[model samples]
Target: MAPKVTVLDYGAGNVRSAVRALEHVGAEVKLSRDPQDIREADGLLVPGVGAYAAVMDALKASGSLRHLGYRIAGGRATMGICVGHQVFFEAGVEHGVRTEGLGEWPGVVERLPAPVVPHMGWNTVQAPEGSRLFEGIEDERFYFVHSYGVLEWNFDVTQPAMRPPLVTWAEHGAPFIAAVENGSLSATQFHPEKSGDAGAALLKNWMGTF
Candidate 1:
């Protein structure tokens, strides 16, 4: 049977593109705000677009965040896109407010310093050796538009880190954590759906993992 993947809907996110991407990859996909839908999914895709605090609150209010932890802890495959990636960290320091994150990974979501509030446009990403998601996918460019990025994390050390530590694949002239993967959980600060062929291939690779 094809893996059933759920694209989380927290109201603060635009899940249509992700849903289309997953469908394009041959997986059975659904847009769900219910906790049960997430619990039963073979893989989960958390996609978001909006402020850190508002998105966090929407996830909690929908009860998807709590169930997301359950899915990850159970060894199920999961992925976070853009702001969705930020919410996986311990907290987000945006707009002078500190909001709690899912804390699945040990990191803090912080804004890019001066001259780089929102890193927009297409950029390249290099996956380190032995990365499952980047198996056949080469160093390709993808679309990214975001103001905040994952600054640092301790979770990468305790467990086997994915991609690389402290190396920026491509950014607005500065390096930052572009992508991260640990076990079955993975995240990228870019929009794979908007990345054209390269991005589609990356999404295909992720679904193929299951």
Candidate 2:
């Protein structure tokens, strides 16, 4: 049976575009806000375009966020886009408001400070070796329109000096973590749907992980 991939619609996501993109990749995709739908999904894609606090509140109220986390932690493939990516972090400091997040990835989300608030336009992505989400996708450019990014941290407790480390992919005006992959969970600060051919291929690669 083809795996049913669920695109989460928590009132804060661009669910339609995400679903269409996933479908284009030849995957069985569904746009759902129901917990049952998410629970039975083979993979989960969280697409968003909004404030962190608002998105978090919607997920909490709907009880979809917690269930989604459980599914991912249980070894289900998951992907997050843009603000959707940011919400997977421990917390967010956007627009000067501090908000707690899903705590899936250990890091803090903060706005790209200074000269650039929202880093918009096409930017190149460096896909590190062994990245399944970026298979067949070379050093390609993708569409990005975000002001927030994740601050990578060291997972080992013994390595205190190496702890709270940062893993940056692309450097715009400054270095920022654009894409992150931790175990089965992966996320991107760029919009693959709006990224044309390269983005389409990238989404296809991610869906293939299921």
Candidate 3:
């Protein structure tokens, strides 16, 4: 059977596009609002499109905050998109207010240093060697429409005892973390669903992981 992927619809993302993308990649997609679906999902895709504080607030209101964290920590094959990827950090600063995130990894989301406020449109990414997310589409540009992003990868992934994440980067005014793959947790700063062929290839790569 195909992997049953659930797209968390906590009232923050363009869920329909993500669902359509996932389905196009040959995975069985489910739109979910219940925390129970998150717990039982073969794979989870948390999609978001908005400010960090607001999205975090919506996730909290939806009551899947704890469950989402639990699944990622327990290695439940979770993937986050756009602002969904932003919430993987420890916190995010939007309009001078810092909001706590799911903290799937140690980092912070802040405004990009680009001259343009929002880094909108297609851009190529610098994927690490052996990237499972970028896979065959490493060189292709993906769609991005965001003003905030994670600027660095803090932990030492080179340690033999640790499994380092595959960190991908892209630059507007400066380089920023565009994507990450660590164990069962994976994410993208760009909207792969909105991206064209490159996006579809990336989604297929994610489904193949499960």
For every model shown, what is its TM-score relative to the native structure? 0.89, 0.89, 0.95
Q: Please give, for residues 3-55, the per-residue lDDT of candidate 2 as tens digits.
A: 68888878875678777777777778888878877877878888888788888
* Each candidate's clash count: 0, 0, 0
How would you encode candidate 1's per-residue C-alpha lDDT over 1-210 as one tens digit per residue?
Answer: 777998887785567888888887788998887888888888888888978888888888887767887888888889889988788778998878899988766778777764855788887776777776666666777889998877654545445645333333445545567777777888888998888887788888887777
Candidate ranking under lDDT, highest first, comes to 3, 1, 2
Candidate 1 is scored at a TM of 0.89
Error of 3 at 209 (Å): 0.8
Best by lDDT: 3
Model 3 pairs whose backbones collide: none
Model 1, CA-based lDDT? 0.78
Could you tell me how far off, in angstroms, the CA of residue 119 lies in candidate 2 after the best superposition?
1.0
Clashing pairs in 2: none
Worst 10 residues of 1 by lDDT: 161-170
**Cα distance off (Å), candidate 1, residue 135:** 2.3
Best by TM-score: 3
Report the Cα lDDT for candidate 2.
0.78
Query: Mind giving the per-residue lDDT tens digits that candidate 3 earns over 1-210?
Result: 888988998997568988998898888988987778898888999999889989999998998888887887777989999999999889999889899988768789999998897999999999999998887787899999999999877976677888877899999888999999998899999998999899999888887787
Candidate 2: minimum summed lDDT over ten consecutive residues — where?
159-168
* Number of colliding residue pairs in model 3: 0
